[model samples]
Target chain A: MATQSFKTYFGRNSRQGLWYVPLLITVVGAVILTVYTDDFASPQNLSNLLSQAMPLIIVAIGQMIVIVIGGMDLSVGAIISLTTALLALDAPAFVLVPAVFAITALIGLVNGYSIVKLNVHPIIATLSVQFIVVGFARILRPVAGGSVPDIVVSCVAGTVFGIPLTVFWAVIVLLLGWKLIHGSRYGLHLFAIGGGVSSGQEDAAHNFGISDQRNVILAYVCSALFAALAGFYIAGRISSGDPGVGETFALDSVTAVAIGGTQLSGGIGSLHGTLFGAILMVLLSNGMNLANLSAFLQGAIKGAILLLVVSLQSRKKMGL
Target chain B: MGAIAANPVLQRAIRVPPAYLVFAVLLITLWVTKPQLMNVNVMGIFIRQVAPLGILVLGQLLVMRVRSIDLSGAGVLLVVNYMISSGIMGDVPAIAYIAMALSVGLAVGLVNGYLVGRRRVSAVIATLAVTVILTGIIQFLASGKPPGDMPGYFNDIYNTKIWIVPTPVAFWLLLTVLMSLFLSRFVFGRFIAAIGENPTASHFSGVPVERTVIASHILASVIASVAALVQSASVAVGSIRLGLEMPIDAVAATILGGVIFGRGDGGVWGPFFGVMCFALLFVVMTSFGVPDPGKQIARGLIILLAAIFYGLSSSEK
Candidate 1:
């Protein structure tokens, strides 16, 4: 019985995916880092790592939402960049914060509408949006300079009852992600839609009365919202808006989602898997930085890791 | 909407590639607005600027026809540029440099093919990852050793003209003609058409689907490398910060030319004019005094509009 249960948990065909594999790798990686480096176990470094990993974890969770429905959003990085730019505009905190979310929602809506109504491919649609958004961001703030609202900064940097705010940030984001991805019927519909897509039956979920189009659109919205949240967090940390700040988040979020044992072909994944995957990426970078590895080499290594991880996951479709 | 789509005249118009129409429109716009700039010498320079992109598009349309993509051109371009300009290759003859660049293209192409065609990985992620790896390596090398000046011969070759047409422009035209002939007159063209129409049906009918896709990728990468050589030659010095816009522009031009993933309705000349559209677009933008950010927005808008055109038409069909 135990063997059967174990097989189901880690099996290739499981809906949970091979998530345990990354979890295992994360554990092994953490142990190795602790043993090898004097600074790895320090509270300061550990906290720093959490803070560094937070934005990615958030963005990956958003990416996971879209990937779950056999779609992608390359515009997330641009959305994040735009968010920071807007926040840094000389405005009141209350006005800037809501304005950011509203703008991102509209962007997501357009992305969803393009994919659903106009029948544009997900990558092409998102890529065009990415360029458009980035153009606007660059126009708004050519370089990174203007200060963010004071309230946003304090929320991210302040401690709560002797615990760092990043810890609270982690708990809240994870809880929300878990609720949206696992605890809701909407999440189930996303899987149904993605399963149909990967299986080459685009209408299977719709046949079941799932309203797949609306769900897919909502998923894109959530993705944009999460990216905006990540942008907000970064704006707080940096205390200023940088037009190019979120340039890498699009690919990084995709890498994180894929590493979490989430199939890029869609239909199978777990929140914990994504969490572990984000942690693994952060861990690898942390260890590499401590070892004095060149930043460029570290980038190449990360790319290799993404390549290796994706190659292992078999898929049905042949194109992007 | 349905009634309009059903009209025979509209249907026929839709079948015609948008590239030709856009090219004509832009040409007329240019002739009317900037009559002085329409001369051969001035026009030749503008067209020559897009020769590298035009060459890259030839490969892009081939792969897209077979339902795959390659975003790794930037990486290949960066590496080739680095090799020639970094002087790390250490005074190699120009021929030797050309051979080395082609070899690098061949290697990257083979890897992309193996992953996309055989392993069935998403072509976007695979090629994008390859680009990231190449970019990282180039950055690392450049950081350790600063980039140096290009050999003067490349610029000389780049500047030469054949009967008032620049050498690069002539070269780009030759490649396009060769590509068009290869696709229309050869068995490989038939294979590409069959595969694009239906991979499974083509495979069952004895077409080597995987081999063809792999070959297409290898050819595309090699073509991109040649474009890179020209691009590197056009510049006076090597820099690590090569624009990533080339591959994306290639995609835009290919789509604007009417060759989308798994469909090659536009054929060679359609995309040829598509490249011409870009050439004219720059002139128009320059005359209008559009800034860099506006140009970026225009690029994005063009791709979106062209894709939507195809998307709407295809869905209607």
Candidate 2:
């Protein structure tokens, strides 16, 4: 009976997944970094770290929503790039900001419609969209030097009442993510749909009276919206638009979600786990930089980590 | 829509790979607008430029047939390019270079096969991670070194012609033929087809599904290495810039040829023509003065439209 309970807690089929494992790893990693590096414990460095990790955490939370339904979104990076470009245009804050959200929602709608209605595969659909979006972004900005609205820049620059404004951003984003992934009926429905899709019964959730198609579409839209939010934050921080700024976020967010113990096959993940995953990635990078490791070698190490983490989570299906 | 779906002729046309249609359309467009550029020598030069891509598509089609994919071609191309150009191998003979390149390909292929076939990881993530790792290592090694010149022999071989066709173009065609024959004549071909149709059914029917997938991945990686050799030879010097676009183009071309996950309606020649379409596309875009971003958008649109065509057709069936 004890073994059965333990298995239920950590089994491959468990809905919660082994999320605590990443939490444990994150704590351990943080402790090690704190001990080994003098700068890690400093207040300024900690604040900088929070800001540095905020965008990824925001993006990963959104990515986890789609992964829970057994779909991948490769266009998030491009959407982020497009967001910055749109924001950097010589326009008012109100117009530019709303326009960014509207454009991203439209992109998300097309992505969701292609996969859900047109029967295109998620990866291929989003990959094609990625190219198209990036091309448009390049046409808009071409290179990285355009000024953002003053209000946009100020949102990320200063502290609020002895605390960094980044802390407030994290709190807001995390609450929103938590509500979407853990607090709402839609979140439960997403897991139900993903559970069915991963088990080779693509219609299981639909048979249970869940509007699976709409939910899946919404998930993609949410993912895109989150990417846009991250792009907004990045643009504010940099005070400019860059066509290539978000190039790594798509893969990086995937890595963060996967490291958090979410099954890429779907239906098993946690918001806390994703938070820890993003933190772990940022921590690893920070520690590496402090250790004076070669920047190029850091990429290889991260790749190895991704491979190692994914290899441990075995799945039934073999292909893309 | 219902009427079109019910028509026999329309059904037959839908079943045909779009690559052939696109190829014909592009050929006519070129012939009509730029008749002078339609000569054999000019076309040969254009076709030769895409020989590496054409070769890469052969491997891509094989893996896609079995419902897997290999995006590590870019990494393999980069590593091989670095090896030949960086002179990191310490003054090796030509045969030694060939051996090293093949060995590297073999090693990468085995890792990919193990990860995707045995470990059952997502093929995209596994192969993409492999690419990142390889690219990172190459960049690290080539950090302080300047781009180096290629051995003169490679350029010489690249320029050679066989009966008015560039050697690389002929070689690409020869490989495509060999691939077609191998798929038609060997038991392995049957294995791949069965696995693609249904993995569980193939397993119950006593097919070695895992082994077959692994073998296909190995072959694909080795073939990608050969493509890399051709790509490296075409360039005069080695630089650290990533050729990530090549594998993506190969994926687009393969899909254009009617080869999606677990399907191969176009076979080898369809993708051969798909590569031909790309050659004409570049020429057309250049002559029209389309910028780089425009070309990127065009490439994306082509892939999207082609995949949508297959998706609709498959669903109808």
Candidate 2 iRMSD in angstroms: 0.9
Steric clash pairs (candidate 1): none
Model 2: per-residue Cα lDDT over B1-317, one tens digit each: 66777789988898789999999999999899999998999999999999999999999999989999899999999999999998878887788878878888898999999999999989888989999899888888988354598888998999999999999999999999999999989999899988888999999999998999889999999999999899989997997765568988999999998888888888888888888899999999998898887888888888888888988887777
lDDT of 2 at A142: 92
Residue A133 CA error for candidate 1 (Å)? 0.5
Worst 10 residues of 2 chain A by lDDT: A7-16
User: Which pairs clash in the backbone of model 2?
Assistant: none
Instruction: Name the runs in model 1 displaced over 4 angstroms.
Output: A1-9, B144-146
How many angstroms is residue B249 displaced in model 2 relative to the true structure, after the best TM-score fit? 0.4
Residues B82-170, candidate 1, lDDT per residue (tens digit)? 99988888878999999999999999999999999899888888998999899889999898554999999999999999999999999
TM-score of model number 1: 0.97
C-alpha lDDT of residue B178 in model 2: 99
